[model samples]
Target: MLHTDAPGNTRQNGRWSSIVLIVKMLLTVAWRNLLRNRRRSVIVFISIVVGITAVMFNDGLSIGMISQMLENSIGSHVSHIQIHAKGFNDNRVIQNNMATPSEVENVLRDTPGIAHWSPRVVSFGLLSSALNSSGGVIVGVDPEREQDVTTIRRSIVEGSYLTGAPREVVIARRLADKLQVGLGDKVVGMASALSGDVGSDLFRVTGIFETVSSEFDKAYMFTSIDNARSMLELEDRVLEYAVIVRDINEVEDIAASLRSKLGDEYEVLTYIDLLPILVSQVDMYQSMMYVVYLIIALAMIFGIINTMLMSVFERIQEFGVLMAIGMRVRRIFLMVLLEAGMLGVLGTAVGLLLGSGLLLLFSHIGIDFSIFSEGLTSFGVGAVIYPRLTPDTILNVLIIIPLTTVLGAVYPAVRAMRLQPVAAIRYV
Candidate 1:
């Protein structure tokens, strides 16, 4: 019994050794086959590199563009969160203004995540200059607090931000151009007060600003809170309280906390809620990327299938010889698959290195599209975009490339496995 068990163990050990040897042999042969056809392999490799590089570059650009849009919109106007009187968003009437300014201020000041907060008196009115008139939103802000909450102060292209001087106003560059008004020019604004009286005021354009969003630049104007209160006939009432958080990503959490603490009298909204158009644009861009990736994958699939088919046909006699010398059909199939996988691995590695290097270089220098500045600004995107890459994108590429290669090699691998040794050898 002991002798018999010893013989069985020896046989099992030999079988394991043979499996390892077969795997090593298969890998070596696959490596050799890739090297044997230098030109063809290089052609396939280059195609894959080009495809991957294009994908990475386009993805990076899309991400950068979206990021810039969000940054501009948030920094320029939205802040991270906004607190408003219920129903104020739907109607711009003075009656819908925030009634408890002190309570809102207390909550903001007490909030741990709050970076800055500013109360604003917002109203819709017709702004008129000597040359032109347009309907726009007039926002009254606190100069010092507003500067902390937004980049409006920094965006001043000409003139200065509100100085609390009586009737001092800040207008956008586009509005200034259309109105044909320069710094110190007087502009008139007309609106209806909550008391059902026509309210009108004369404003001196003390500052001009340019922002990434053309719509915002053309449709908004600002003044000191004191001037707005006087013009709108309001007493210490604000339409909205805009709050900036330390981290933009934590805005929703902060908003939720504010909502619970402030009770139902005030409505708390994050930037995403305030800017639905921007949210929709981001979703649309992400959906479009899916289509783009699908197209790229299809292109890669076809190219790989063509290359693998050629490789299989070229190695027909060699495969037949192997089968004739006792190689199993499954091993033949596996070898073909291995070759395709090796190609994918090589191509993907080189592509990632090249693409990442290019992205890093461009991220610092940025890609300038100043020629399309007008169009880019219309979408609230900067003319110079700094490319970005996320870990999810890299993981997707790593998974997709190998899967694409395997799918492309399936038919060729099966064909190689199904070959009749005698017929294949004779035909070749």
Candidate 2:
């Protein structure tokens, strides 16, 4: 071999080494330039910090609201999944009930992820007290099983939960108020029986429960499955089955499994399906955040541009001297860009630290917005909100802040590059 390629490799390595040295020099010069204008740099740095912190805190509040809504809705009544007769979700009539309930019960029992399941006789009816009458949905449940799947027992504000006693009913606080009834008050429930006639029964109000939702409170009444069966003239059939799973994150998989096992006769629905509006709200929130990020980025871009432009104007003569001594125009441009990059990197790092700290603190202590309690309750959310720092929000900030700073530096960097060395050096 001639070994001629050895010189070529050596020259390539030398060129790469030269590039690295030039980069190191440019970084040092950029850093020194930033230090020369500490006040302006600090001002821009503080703006970024404040902006990032505000955005993070706002996003955290939204996440907390959506999380609370989901928890309250699921804990109150929806459960993790619901199994209904094929037409029951749409029609919800006495005729549209599960005929062979034993098979569904068996599947629920054998399913590994199912924690608890409760059967319900759901029917629309008129509930009347001695004082007044109101229309609501009647839910017949097994007292003990319902306790495991729903928070109705814990939500009892007054009186007692169902004890398998005959004709005992649990009414919501709003319904109670509407009917001018309280615990122990006698109420009449009327519904359409399977015999093509109206069926009616007398019940004693045993408990009054108040959840976060006023609508849910006013719209539903709970009674023993036996009493409901007796009044409705039904056999051992059920209209719906509410199921709770061991883990909520696995609900979609569990629902799919249940659907496969149960076949087409039954409808397997998850909380996501039951509460579509809430799911939409969560998605809408994420979409709306992009608009918020745009606003913040725009503000940051302008701030960086004003600061960097001022720095460039002040250093016009200095740039002229460097270029006069044979510094390339591209090197001047790269130096300006490096200065902006430094600002972005430093500001973003500090901002993330402070923002993340605040999120962690609020996640533990929570923020009280009880002043808006009435409004929050209407949406099935709690008064206290715990801020969470999600990975997506952090990733967006890490990308946006630095990109905004660099984009802002473009005009100033170009202006520095266009300087005529002789004319700039002679300027006052």
Candidate 3:
């Protein structure tokens, strides 16, 4: 018999091997079985969809809410990056650090990967309007370019961005309200230098800017860096550096790179670093997302295991017949697993659709939490929460849903395959 067998056919024979063919056959069988019980398949589909929708939308909205607040906090006043005097971070007092606008501007303009650069001077002072005076912080910025980097463009509610060092300024809506001044009002900014030699005498109100973060919105005043320099008696110098980048994703990369390149002489800080609370918050959300996915995956696994067990009990004769017809018990077990896998695939698809739908809807209209702002004062989170969408979160759900379903079916599948042929065949 060996002598008669074709001599060079082994390589060709291996191409049509039993295991490969078995998988194909098993998948086909699983598909047929699934279609045989359309109602059950549909139930599993609905469960997966519900789970995914809740997870995706809840996370998305949560992200958006935080993103909105962060934008208001970071984007409006703080540029993406700030280079300051090495020891100045601990004491952000105005006099301790200074950079010349034109000097820094020349270096920044030539620096690759930067979008825009600005020299800013920050000071805490008393803002006196025509009739009333309110305490606030004064922020000196370039009027025209301020719009390019932040949410400031939409925040000017009453008048206009300061123009041409008009002694003109933009105050927060809260400060404007507290000061009882609207458009075309003059406010005095009073800040004394460390030696009491330099101080802000006065400024005219050009506009009132509104934002979700009342802290910055109420206290901040925008003026031309020139006007700010003049008022503070700071000629040709700035308190710190403000830089924007090409993308938000590159923040940490840029921060790290800047730290290395700029070295220890200057402190390079990202907008995220400037506000530690927000960075901590985003980290907390990410940690919680992991826990959520784990819980949801375990729950989904249980659902799948239960469904598969039910199917095994319901189809004992089918297994007996397969065994009786010479189909290996291992193949029978594998087929059951394939069925579970198929369910997972279908469920994942449905979940993604529902999750995407929820994301789209929330992205547009926003989730309003304005009614709860008073209570939220405790957490420092705004009352109206917005959910933002990102690819990482979406990818998480994509990886989890099917993995849960497949893992859940493992035990039940093994039990089904191990059934004694006589017992399974004798089931009444």
TM-score of each: 0.94, 0.91, 0.87
Q: Write the per-residue lDDT of candidate 1 for residues 101-163, one digit (tens) a residue.
A: 998898888998899999999888899998899988888899889999888999998988888
Full-model lDDT, candidate 1: 0.87
Residue 127's C-alpha lDDT in candidate 3? 85
Clash pairs for candidate 1? none
CA lDDT of every candidate = 0.87, 0.90, 0.76
lDDT of 2 by residue, 66-115 (tens): 88898889988899999998977788789988888899999999889899
lDDT of 3 by residue, 308-376 (tens): 898888998788888888888888878988998888888778888878877887677766677876544
Model 3, stretches more than 4 Å misplaced? 1-16, 129-133, 252-264, 361-389
Give the runs in model 1 whose Cα sits over 4 Å from its true position.
Answer: 1-21
Error of 3 at 98 (Å): 1.7
In terms of TM-score, which candidate is stronger, 1 or 3?
1
